[model samples]
Target: MALLAAFVGTPVAAAADDPDLTSFYQQKLSWERCGQDLQSGARSDGAGQPPGFRKRLECARLEVPRDYGNPGRSTMQVQLIRLKATGPGKRLGSLVLNPGGPGASGVNYLIDSGNSFANLGRRYDIVSFDPRGTGHTEPVSCGSKLAPPPGSGADDSLAAKEKRINEACGRYSGGLLRWVGTQDVARDMDVLRAAVRDDKLNYLGFSYGTKLGAVYAHEFPRKVGRMVLDSVEDPTKNAWQTALSQVRGFQRALDDFAADCTRQADCPLGTDEGKAQDQLRHWYQQLSEQPMKVKGETVDETSYVYALREALYSRSDWPALRQALEQLRHGDGAGILRLSDAGGGSAAHSDSVPARRIGQDELPPQDQLALRAISCRDTSERYGADDYPRAERELTKASPLFGPDIAPTLLDCYNWPAAGDDASRDVAAPDAPPLLLVATTNDPATPYQGAFNMARELRNSSIVLTYRGEGHAAYTTGDPCVQRHVDDFLLSGTLPKSHTSCS
Candidate 1:
């Protein structure tokens, strides 16, 4: 998810002797058309304002302080986009959006899927922005040389890669690395709320965006307007806890996909779910020992494992997964490579064959580095190399397929140089108006339990809107019930009674 700020007509005046951010708060924004020929990579200019771009989207840049504490010294430009309300009715204020990825560009997300919010946009301006260390927002880069090449998943190798990544980030990220945490982003949101002239924040955040929204509500409860947190992230979870939960969640999602696949006539893993899971595990083990060559490209254990996890994110991708597994069973790595590509595996390692174009929702190298930097800085958890053995055993016991892979990821934060001041705090927004929490029961990314936990944390001020389906999030997945509730809340501040289920 993302946060944005802009200075309209008059600059927002700063406090008399406080943080001296008045100049930044008062800077004006200029918008220009954008998103013409987006498929071919055409974009706006340096100011992020496209000249004569034929899209309704208008792009601009918001200059926020690199460090709010030192507002005048240096600044980072945040990319912003706006889709004005196409209304026949009374217009509400801006409804800002964040599409999860601590790395995802909210500006691009709104450009691609603005119509999804048409119902709400008719009543409110739809606004989005690329948060710090993300697209066009003074992005953080840790040199691709430090990035682990695709299929390189050995424990020792991963540890070495993590070390290199840490060193590289420290070298290249400037001092902005420590300030990119969600807390900092939330502070940016407050400045944005004021600049946009919204009395209160009206926001819709998905996946990681939920965490951002919750932080915002906690930090500025009174400034929160109608908010929807889809696929909620548990604010109470430390990094290790969050990783473990995700391991188990992905395992459950894989099991569900495997079970459903067995019912299909072309199911490659056969009719027995247990045997199929074992087959997959065996495949991973074998690939680890001897990488397979398919379509003139190598398919290693790490790639296959990541592909499986990716396919499990949504049931709609199950068909492709099944085909990939079938091809794997037949000694053809082509399908596996294709699935890996879909899962954000590096294209450099992929074969030159013309594969179907998967949506480029995958984070760029800089964005991925930023994701790690922000995540490491935001949480207090520090996992050392020695902590892996016990964690591996426990995680594997809980989730045999995904545990091993997920456990090593914790090591990335080992010996992280930057430290964040905002420890995990109680997210109870007692003073905030009603908030809506949306949870997909079988969500693979943000597990359903996190939503329940967030609802409880927020106490009576929040309502949990349950989508009894399988996916990462609820809204825009063709669930009219979910959309209706979100629209109602955003349009009229209607909060469903606690624990309302929309199957």
Candidate 2:
């Protein structure tokens, strides 16, 4: 499948006088043709065209050395998209963005919401690309195994279900998972940078994308021109720590949601905020024993309620949560399941949604072994057999909403073929460029503390702004303060003072 590419490109040549690309690549950088069918002046659809959005702009594949360490025999194509600046002369450079998820496609991101980048789209050429094994870039599928349990509730047969899914994932995703690590994505970014002939790369990443941005900074610090990492993830923390922190984040958000619900008369939980929480706890305890019967469907405690809570992580979906809760209070599980499936469904189910826009596929079936190998080789020593139960107990106390899934998801890494990376590496490199990190005080997905840690480690960097609101990322929600701060930094290279707050 050909990757969809977008964004504008300008002709930029390396300075012959400079020893390395430092002068031209980092300073006074310009865009170039990327040497693909997606030209500097126009757009083209390359491969893997989605059904309805078939006419969406296409991309050209620029084959790069699959492994940077061994550039000779290996090769992989990194997909790119470009949307030229709307305002002429106002254009300075290209602004690359990633919408978190690690699996989110940059190309489709520009397609669906490119305009949200007010003042930005006018001043800089906007471009996004699918990282390798993502989107149109030779995707990675864990086959049908990693798919969410069908319908609203999980399979009652836990052991058998887990064994089945794990075996399927292991079998279908042969070796691609190993190469889907951040390092590989970073290399793709470098290739995209060189392909466009940019002197320096300006980046805006959210959630998991922030981790990608951080890794890129560490790998190619000098190449970083202006970076805004919103809803940041800490590069220093191991996957387990990061996941555990999300448990707390999700709990806080749940509290906030429950409190808000009390203000609404429609809130079935109750008008008293504390009472509402108690009611929720009671509901979970009750459902754990006797699952609810919704439309003749057996709605289990773990799947249904947790799905509703997860939906609350993004304010944009709060209304749906309210509706789901109302439906559940009346004994209807179908609505909640549908909503959850829409929001959390795997690629196969949501294939109708533009592959590049809704989400990015983690790894192709071919790379699972590689993903396991690299992750285990990197982070194996950090976990033990006791980790799962410990995480479960700890998370249960953290938040009633996400406690169950948070720990289990993280613990999956403990049993993963590859444990994890040596998170001990010094994440903050002094040589790295000044970075703008954005954090939400109550982000359920990435968590705020992780953002703080990322900022601390990137000593040269500054907190462009922190959102006091709740959500995974404020940029997509059109937070004025976030939008402005990002615009200023990318357009003018100005960073807000330390610990800046966004209303």
Which digits, one per residue and each the tens of the lDDT, describe model 2 over residues 1-503? 01211122211233554223222113222334444233332222323323433233345556655655455546666677766666855667778887655555566565555556757877777778777766666665556425545566644343334334445555764455556667767766776675665667788887667767877777777777888887776666676666667667667788888888889878877799888888877767776788766566566766565565556557777777778878877767666665654442111111001111111223223223223333443454444345656766877777765676555444234444323456423456567778888888887777677777887787775564788887777776678888888778888888888878987
Candidate with best lDDT: 1
- Candidate 1 least-lDDT 10 residues: 345-354
lDDT of each: 0.72, 0.60
**In model 1, how large is the Cα lDDT of residue 168?**
72
Residue lDDT tens for model 1, 320-424: 999889988888888888777663211011100111211212223555666777777776767776787888898889877677777766776776778755453
**Best-performing candidate as measured by TM-score:** 1
- Model 1: CA > 4 A from native: 1-17, 35-54, 147-157, 343-364, 422-425
Q: For candidate 2, which ten residues in a row score worst on lDDT?
A: 350-359
